[model samples]
Target chain A: MAENYQHIQTAHCENGVVTGLLKHQGLDFMTEPLAFGLGSGLFYIHIPFLKVSGGPAISFRTVPGAIFKRTCKALQIEVVRKKFSNELLAQQFLDEKIAQGIPVGCQVGVFHLSYFPKEYRFHFNAHNIIVYGKENDTYNISDPVMETVTTLTIEELKRVRFAQGVLAPKGHLYYPKSIENFDKKLIQRGIVKGIKRTVNDMLHIPAPIVGISGIRFTANKVKKLRAKLGIKQGGLFLGQIVRMQEEIGTGGGGFRFLYAAFLEEAAEYLQDDRLIPISEQITKAGDLWRSSAVQMAGIYKGRITEQKDFDDAANMLYEIAEVEKTAFKQLEKLKFNS
Target chain B: MEKKDIPQDTSPLKNMTREVYYVKNSDGKYETGLSAGWVVKNEALENAWEDINEQVRAAKQAVLTGEKSPIYYYFVLQLMDYNVLSGYTGFWKFSIKKHMTSKGFKKLSDQKIEIYAKVFNITVDELKNFNH
Candidate 1:
């Protein structure tokens, strides 16, 4: 879908030909004229094959911190990489395709670069990156003008001597000011369509079936794919399940403490009703998990004389898988109801 | 001056913040030296000097009681990211910086580092741990 949009968008922007043949392309947008107050920009758009299936394996810099910074950093890396310090934000992404600076399959979005006489401005590949840096008398990419990988620091080097990387608490995400004017366009080009191929091709991504995104898309769309596989997407809440477990007896024993937490979050986007909120789910999953674990213990102990421990564990996991399917189906079905 | 001052770094820097690395010399005492680089300010930084002050104080306390800071010994700790730049809520943490017998040498493991980031609620890049 994203690639199709880009194809037409590129032809329209580049060749100035709004060909009807560009049907699958994504340029058919009609918007109430945006209030272009500070807007001064140009860009061309195109689709690259970086798009991944299994939802293109999107990674969220999940380390935690400001969501904006993580997003900006991604933009920054690409912008500086393209060397388009002169392009307009509107067209920076389009220009990047030509710059051939960044490896192919990487597209610029909303990110552009500004060129100045003394210093090349912008730290990130993106222009108008939210964080600003101070450079010389003029505003440019922030730095001593020389950026060092964190490992080059004395502290970092010291760790390297031991063959281990320094582990520092990631506090925040920020980029130099120079890249600010280097606005990003199509920064989304590959993100929506480019990054998948790049990661898969360059990194030899292990699970091509799933890409880098740990979450699966069938589950993202159909919602009950996990249940269809006869398993829960995440887990079952034990706290809530404890109440029900006593009611369901051995049936509720399959819950795990971690279920509710992942489910609660999963529900926010998936919007399933039977989904337990994260907090209650933890305790609830724990309660249910523990009971099931107890019952499984009896079964295992009884079977231990005849079966290997690994086999028993596998059997237990399978049992848990069954419970997950029931809960996911219930939650999903309830989602439609609500 | 000792390393990494390369002429090939043509990328101009702006808003460079002067930093001092407090290093221990042959005399077994610490001295501050200069290192300048860009200081990127996040309008939405989550951890403030206030939140980490206790840990700093704890480190200082260790220094006072002949127990060096965990940072002094390990330079690593678990972190929780509240995600709110101005103010954080629902954050949690634990200590992970490792202790080495040698002076001025701190090491962190990749796996443990990943966990430290998860605990800190930060990305690996933002951990002041990435090169670019």
Candidate 2:
């Protein structure tokens, strides 16, 4: 079952799973950037009331399963997704799929994933992986974040699959059921739809805690963090942002650079030269975010503790918010021939 | 970021797989590149671990002084907060908070203790007897 399976490394897990599964089913055009683009994976939200691992819940991308679901929906591919309430049934279902030689994607927590580095293992439960085959009691895993394929024992897999917490997997497993041959025009249409949705998401969302407004809100809060929460707690807060933006599977710059890469790919696929410049704009935003991360690191590391340093970081984010706002506005105005 | 500019600082991911990143080449085209690690991110991760360890130490001290239960120490050791512990054991957050106290843990039935032990992946005896 694993003979023909090819492991593809990607910057993020969900995008990698979607790209790999589609490529396995004979869709050669499936790339990580294209998958992320068509899935509208770029997003930002800061939920102050929620805490993830003692830090404020800050997300750099859309929700966990949205990429796979949206990418599949846009491509008109039939898929099977299941979440089990019974552990035995979940194991049985996965075993049946593996026996049938069908590679399936499973949502498991990273906290108990034995192959991950101990320091990276937290209570994060949204990690995605592909189980292509089973050899004895071990399952062949293709975690896209890693450089090569890995394995997990049956018990280890079960533990991670049933890891209980916020956004628990509950033995969730998914696979593409039917993949039909699609032409370039279908992809072009998907690109248009994806960009429209992303433009709306980043610009038209009414809530202050999401999209561009979310970036500004977080920046405003960042300016006052030292005064409001004191130095130690505020430094921790900045460190949390840095970790979420750079440490996790964001492809660096909190998915901004990845989105820019997506826009570059989409420009070529759609034969739209206008998108190239907009992609550059987003890249500029990504560069600014990196600078902001560096500034934040200095403050969090105690090398710089002045309020002006904090203001400088906040100002960088404010500029990033403007850059992204303009880029999305341009995308919203551009007409596509679909 | 440029292809050559990607940071390769020492990190916990050392000897493990490098992460994939999107970067620009000299030609200015975006491409996927492998990054060993970055110091900025490493420091953030280390800071987070430090916070966790600090909490664990405090919890251990509390348990040793009979101010809190052993379950509290185990929960902190496992990097779990009250919400996560509640989710795993199917207990209410307030109830779990109460169970963290010495008096509340002393009254726990065997079945309840078994559930906590299972969640922590430790034997009942180990859970019941935590010296350090």
Candidate 3:
């Protein structure tokens, strides 16, 4: 069963899981960008009250498990998801799925994953991987973020599945129950639905700490960070932003580039050249995000401590917020042939 | 970023795996590319580790001076804070705070000590007699 399962490396975990599982079910048109777009995965949120790893709780994509759930919903696929409080029950359930040759997606903590690099091992618990088969005490793992498939011992798998702290997996697993062929019209409709949802999320969300507003809110915080926290702590805060932006799963520039790629693909699928210009706009936004990261890195590295540097970084984010706002607004205005 | 301009700086993920990046090619079309690592991300990770190490060092010194318990040292070593430790052990924040003190830790029963040990993934003996 492991040999029959094809591993597809992706830029992010949830998107990869959605794409790989669908592809395994014979959805050949499925790609990372399409999964991301259809799932409305692009997002920006900085929870002011929450602190992760001594910094702000910042996420570049939608909440964990949303990509898989939303993508499957858009494609009208029946998804079976389960969570178990008992570790033994979880293992038994997973083993049964593997014995039936069904590839199952499991949510696990990154900290206990032995194959991950030591530096990348953190307390993040939303990472996703596929378990295609088992041999003795070892389970075959297809972590989308990795270049190749790996394996985890049964104990290791159980530990990660039941890892503690915030957003614990609790031995969660999910898979599409059955897949059926659909028409091109369904794909077009899914793309439009995804784009509309994303536009609303980025532009119309009422919360100050979400969507385009959240980017602006974070920029405002960045401007005041140095004065409020002083040089040492301020630099660490900026470093946290850079880490969240350019980390492995982001596909660079806090997923702006990935969103741009999605928009480009959507344009081709919808046969709407108008989306091409919007995609270019997103690409520019991604470039600005990269530049902002470089600016933040300058302060984090302690080479540039002046207030001006902090302001410059904040200004870049402000520009990004505006650019993303425009992109989403354009998406909102575009009339799709429904 | 442009295909030719995507950064490939050496980073902690050097020998582990190459990460995917979305970049523009010569024809200005979006495509997926692979990068070993980037300097900016590496710096952020290194900075985070530095902060964690600093906290661990402080916890060790506090434990050695009898200001904190072995549990406090293990908590910091495991990259956990009071909030996370409380969540893991199902202990109240104030209880965990109290347990971090040398006096409070000494008053803990074997059963309570075992809970902390399990959360830290260590033996009860290790939790009881952790040396820095």
Q: Largest TM-score belongs to which candidate?
A: 2
lDDT of prediction 3: 0.90
Candidate 3 backbone clash number:
0
lDDT of 1 at A234: 13
- What DockQ do you compute for every candidate structure? 0.02, 0.75, 0.72
lDDT of 1 by residue, A1-338 (tens): 01112211110110111111111122232110000000101101111223211112222111112222223343343212222322243133422332322111211111012222122221112111111211122211111111221112222211111111121211112211223243334233212222222223212334432321222221132233223322221111111122222211011122122123223333443444344432243334334344344432332223322223323433443443344434433433432321
lDDT of 2 by residue, A1-338 (tens): 64588999999999999999989988998999999999999998999788666667788899999999999988888899999999999999999988888889999998899988899888889999999999999999999888899999999999999988888899999999857666557788889999998898899989999999999999998999989887778888988998989865789899989999999999898889899999999988888988998999898888999899899999999999999999999999999888
Worst 10 residues of 3 chain A by lDDT: A177-186
Q: Across residues B35-92, which tens digit of lDDT does each residue of candidate 3 receive?
A: 9888888898999999999999999899989999998898888877665688678999
DockQ leader? 2
Show the lowest summed lDDT stretch of 10 residues, model 1 chain A.
Answer: A32-41
Ten residues in sequence with the least summed lDDT for candidate 2 chain B: B79-88
Native contacts retained by candidate 1: 0.01
Interface RMSD of candidate number 2? 1.2
Q: RMSD in angstroms, candidate 1? A: 23.7
Candidate 1 lDDT score relative to the true structure: 0.25
The TM-score of candidate 3's chain A against the true chain A comes to 0.98
Q: Please give the TM-score that candidate 1 achieves against the real structure.
A: 0.20
Candidate 3 local lDDT, residue A206: 93
